[model samples]
Target: MDLVNSFLNFVVPPASLLMLAFSWPTLSFINVCEWIYDTYFREIDMDNKVAVITGASSGIGEQIAYEYAKRGANLVLVARRDTRLRGIAENARRLGSRNVLIMAADVVKEDDCRRFITEAINFYGRVDHLVNTASLGHTFFFEEATDPSVFPILLDINFWGNIYPTYVALPYLRQTKGRIVVNASVENWLPLPRMSLYAAAKAALINFYETLRFEVKDNVGITIATHGWIGTEMARGRFMVEEGAEMQWKEEREVHVTGGPVEEFAKLIVDGACRGNAYVKYPSWYDVFFVFRVFAPNILYWTLQMLSTNHVVRRTSYIGTGRPLYLEGSPPRKFLTAGPSTQVPVQQQLKME
Candidate 1:
């Protein structure tokens, strides 16, 4: 592994630079032409199309369902919450969906995922799009993690959760020449502090789908949605904090959080997916970091470490239940100590991804 790392470290820089130097102009030109052609000559008609969207009960998933419904798509909405699914299905129908089916199944379970896909196919006869939006997030220091199993559990939900439904839906997607839309995060490449496991899972998801795209090229379209922090239950979910030797969930109390509106972000994702675009990066500002990480990783590392320190300082006390708690307030109260607080101002932020 050391040898492999050393080789990668030695070869990656020049290879990256060469690729950028060699491919940028041609790729940019091709993209321009494609955009012009698509803008003038083509549009994806979602009317009467079938779309299976996991995590559709709330947040971005919920908004995506609304967008598709307004465009006249039939939808199969999947989530663990039966009540929420039923509510969203009603909203989808009101928004102009021809048909809306709700499946209350956890995406992490293979049997549940298989059943959901089978039911979707049985109901719709064909599926034109599969949106793998199911995901999990965690925020805690890796070394201080209380349970060793937390990491694998995170992977099982975030990585494998997306994979299972895609596998079950692939045959139907192939038959329809359908598209796959995956909601992966920017943390996949960024690896922010207090989010190591979440980053690992998303990184795996991005790479897995990228490989799948190449393997199934031209047969099926795949859109990898690389989103930054968006307003969502998953984003505002409690973060784990290290207290002495143990980890505990903390109530996040920061205001003026840096993220886009979920509805707009969802619309962008759906638009990109419908166009068969390869990637959809929201806010677009995050692309700067993606490029910065590639070219100046050491600098990005130091910056993230600084942000993590601020995060630890600003965090409040623990609330054990892993549940959603939304609190509205001014900035967090400062510590009573003499030294300067590691907490940065609201403008300079520490965010969850």
Candidate 2:
């Protein structure tokens, strides 16, 4: 058995490389065909369909809600901030969503997830799409954690926060042959510094949904979106810091947030979900790095290290400097407290009840 195993191992790598080389052109042609069909021919009517989006208060999630609304989809926006959700719901109504329900609930807790899913079913009668966009970002090195207790919340929010809702919504999604849109990160595969836990959690998320896709098959479609840096609060350095730690990195904002706008990313995500795509990546150029990671990992690691070493040595993060960080005019808070400006009148608010 050992001899056979060794023989297979010796043959597999070269054989796999040969197969890949032979198949590359065919695969590329097939992908181009699929892209063409999805772009010009295929269309999934979202008019009046229900889409439930978590982390809908801000960032990519918030923009996705708006994009869905523009497609005439009814929206269920969930977050811990009811005020922000309310404001977003108003804008969604104006954007052409016939109904917009706002629910304030923490995604980390199983009970909260179940409650919101139940409420969404009751309000919409069906959930055609479950978009899991709830996540937290971490910008400190793993070893620099002053409070190790905070580590679990990172996993809980990034992994379980997306899982619990999917678990509860899967049956309903199956009934409608619906789709699940995940807002993951490129850090899942890209070795970015100061994001050890965040990257690990995102990697778990990508794997979970990929496996789930096989089990569910055609009954439910899963669109795993791995995005690069976008202009979100997280990119603005709003990360989960230890107790009394803050994030004040005004000078570094440009360095961290340089990517496509959140609005463009959201539009692409919604379009891909409607087309039943398996994966969507923003700044799609990031896909190139995956080849480097697979074929030449040491090179990838060295390149990333070289690029990040200067920033790492600066030690401006919360754990590095041991000082509260916030933009000069902004409050010293980690989360978004103020709601977005509502252009629609209060009377125009959509009430599910």
Candidate 3:
């Protein structure tokens, strides 16, 4: 066994490289052909189709609802905040959605997920698209967690939240030959700072859907989107903080958000789902870092560590002096005031840290 293992290990790396080298051009050409087909020849007509979106109260989910609305899709918006959902539903109607239904439910709970999916079926008769956008983010470093017991909220919301709805709606989706759109994140693979739990949950979510896609085959379409930061509440620091941990204003906003506007990202997501694209990436440039993470992981790690250390040193919120320290021009509040609706210039919004 040891001799066989040694021989295979010695041969596999060069063999894999040779295969990739020979296949690269063919793969690229095939991808381009697929892109052209998806772009021009294919489109799932969403007119009057029932589309259920979890986490539709705000952020990318809200924008996605509008995109679907423009295509005349009937919308079922689900969220915990009823008041916010009402406002979103109104805007979705104004955007051209023929019929909009709002449901207030927690995505993490199986009962809530089942109830919403059932109600959506009863109302619309069939679900054409099940968009899972319910996710929770955390800002504090994993080691800084004072109460580790609260950590499961991140996984529960970010991972199981998406899974529950997908499970409950899969049968109806299969009946309609519908699609499942997942709003995953680039952190699924990127080893970003202060997002240990969130990253792990997203990684699990991505892997689960990838496996499910194979099992379901062409019966149910799945579009998994992985993008970087947008101008969402999460980007504004409305993340899950560890209990007993102080909320500090970190000027690391730029470090976290380096993607395009949520509106643009949402448009692309809906279009890709309608076209049955397997993956959708916003800003697209983030794809470059995957190569770094794969071929030069040490370099990626060192660079990330350096960036995190620099931000930590310049953190303006609290410096362990017992009391909070607010630097000049920094807000004292824990959460930033940038709402998801606040539009910034596209060029400035896409600027990297």
**TM-score top scorer:** 2
Q: Per-residue lDDT for 1-353 in model 2, tens only?
A: 99999999788867877898999999999989999999988868999999999988877888999999999999999987688788899999999999999888878778998898899899889999999988877666666555554567678888998999999999999999999999998998998877888889999999999999899999999999988877775665543333233211122222344546889988999999998888898888898898788766899999888888755663434432223333233445343211233222111000000
Clashes of 3: 0
Best lDDT among the predictions, by candidate number: 2
Worst 10 residues of 2 by lDDT: 344-353
> Cα miss at 211, model 2 (Å)?
1.2
lDDT of 3 by residue, 1-353 (tens): 99999999888867877898899999999999999999999999999999999988777888999999999999999987688889888888998998999998888889999999999889889999999988767555555444454467667888888999999999999999999999998999999876677889999999999999999999999999988877775565433222133221122232354446889889999999999999999768888788778766899999988988877542221112122222223353332221222322211111111
**Model 1, 218-242: lDDT tens per residue?**
8889999988778765465533332
Candidates in order, TM-scores: namely 0.78, 0.84, 0.82
RMSD of each: 7.7, 8.3, 7.4
What are the Cα lDDT values of the candidates? Answer: 0.74, 0.77, 0.77
RMSD of 3: 7.4
Better of 1 and 3 by lDDT: 3
Colliding residue pairs in candidate 1: none
- Worst lDDT 10-window in candidate 1: 316-325
Q: How many steric overlaps are in each model, in order?
A: 0, 4, 0
